[model samples]
Target: MRNTLIGNGVIIQHGGADYYNANIIRRAINNVRSGCFPSHLYPKECADFVTALAKEHNAALNGDYDRYVFTTYDKASLKDFKSRYDRKHKHSPEEIGFEDYFLLFELIHNKLGVKNPERFEHSVVLRRMFLDSVFNQGKIETINERFSDGFVKWLENNDYIFTTNYDSNLDVVTRLPVHHLHGSFNTLSEIYDPNSFRNQLKDDLLDGEEVDLNYPHLYSTCLVSYVGDLKSFSMTQSSLANIGMKKFVKGYQDSPDIRNQIDEWDESNVLVKRLKEAIRLKSERPELQHSEQYPHKELNDISGALEIIGLSPNNDGHLFTQILENENITEIVFNYFSHQEEADAKRLFGSKNISTRDVREFWLDVDNK
Candidate 1:
């Protein structure tokens, strides 16, 4: 058995699931209807704006022309929104999101000759709404003790573990050097904290611009994007760093106090320091190093086979492509949720270096073995 790569489906299958994105949308709509902000930390202005937006959204959903503003609003932009959504998701805009609602508000507000669309454009209210919703809805108190213990032991035996999950369930269960491909909630917490080194640098750098102490989640996304871009640049000779830098600069451009935070972060951040060390190790020992930046690097570095648990290949084509192309990956054991998923995995990876088993059965076998 080779080192395994676990995905979000593993956590979900293990009873550590959270509310789906659809549920998030519904929760936000419900919150708006109730005239309440998801978090009590939000201001009255934000609450009122969101509530009003929700009323319009509800009306649109119900095709209530008298209540909805679609007819009088920017029809072109609304059509564009629908087209874009359909193209990206292969779904209709009728099933929109919190972000989409904000976009609609911007379109309608612009049409109504609202002089300052910035009120909706740069508002941190939507970001806060999402942060609060996910934080509240995705709380994982505990995992099955037997399963947790068994999984931890399995992780201990593995050479490396890579995950795309943002939750802290794995962190609570194991002390292994599990690389989080997607940003984690823990990272968000660090970025949001006023006392954190990153935030401290921001505070010192922004001259007199008042920091919104209540809405730290808004900045967390930006910081996460920055780190992700930095990591991508380090792994590949991509211009993602430049793009990320531009975003970082734009995010704090108004404040003159701290313009060098991004440049300074490389030297000051403990995580960045560790990442640099990992890069150095990779340079020194090509065979031994497992990259924290690129998931493909770790997959390619594996000397043995690869085991994929609770990941659908269809949703992760990039990762699947890497796995299929990497000659070092001698075999692949994929855990499937259903027959269709199993068939999809087989079709993607082929029968030569691949096998499939039910996720539940796979876990039970692993625990017993």
Candidate 2:
């Protein structure tokens, strides 16, 4: 069987609230709220925090207060941090949007730059944003190229299978057996270019672009329409309509068998058949399949050597844990970036044999190290 290596929040420069980036912001807020400095301290304290954070994250901190609210903390220095968050946080609820939240996170990251056990609650929000494609991860096409090369390289060099709770951008480029555990981001609304899905878009896809392989089918200029005039819109028409329909249906739901059949709908779904096909396709490629079963085939031989990174082993996800436990598979590798994360994962999965690593080192190649 071939080995498997997985990475989350490693290659991407940004991540959710639990992410290394956003947590910096969370830490700063917690620090200020917890008396890291006296309440009477000068706003310069905020500046200092931002500068320290910039140095720690290696992000350049730039932009005035107004602009800072919308910026993702990329690479800012102390000077940069001060310039951004030295203002008051007195905006009304009306001024707050996704961008405000993103910027507020940036402020927090800049402020908590040096505090120990940095809290990036913003990064947690950021992670959820990514999951939901809130701000769409800035400059879609360029990011996609960056991510694609990284993913393909990992798949080709590392003899491993990857399971992503996110979508499957890797499958399109690397053609590896990527199991999209929650579906992908490949959709028409995810790109900046109008003709993203067309072959023409591939011309723009350089060696490491961050394509939204799951959110939308492809990157196109039309995706910008999805974020059109956020202020005027309470919720996207499509999303609101779906929500209304869901409420209506759930209020008067059907039976389990009907739902099961609906879930098993043909052509669009193709789960059981897809797994069967994937198994058949790999039968001839034992070296690649790693002896794991297809969807229908029993995954009995798989020792359940689950390598979890950038995820909470919460009760909501207990079903996945149960899958492994029921199979008597014990070997596991759980990696986390912070003290809080470590404590959380430990509480859920226990301290036994769970190796912890910083977010920075979580995805590094062991062989290379």
- TM agreement with the true structure for every prediction: 0.55, 0.35
Candidate 2 lDDT over residue span 114-222, tens digit each: 2423443334323332233322333322333544345456555533455432344455556766543322344233223333221122233333445444433223211
Question: How many residue pairs clash (N, CA or C atoms closer than 3 angstroms) in each of the candidate models, in the order given?
Answer: 3, 65
List lDDT for all candidates, in order: 0.54, 0.39
Scored by lDDT, model 1 comes in at: 0.54
Error of 2 at 325 (Å): 2.8
State how far residue 46 of model 2 sits from its true place (Å): 33
Instruction: Please write out the lDDT profile of model 1 over residues 1-369, one tens digit for every residue.
Output: 357878757656565434455656555555556765634445445545655665555444333333334442334334434443433233322255555566546544644556533563335556566556555544532443435456777777878777765556666677667666554555533334454333333233333434454444344432111122333443443234334434444444545445344334574775665434333333344333222333346666775667888677755444566567777777888889899899988898884488888988977866776
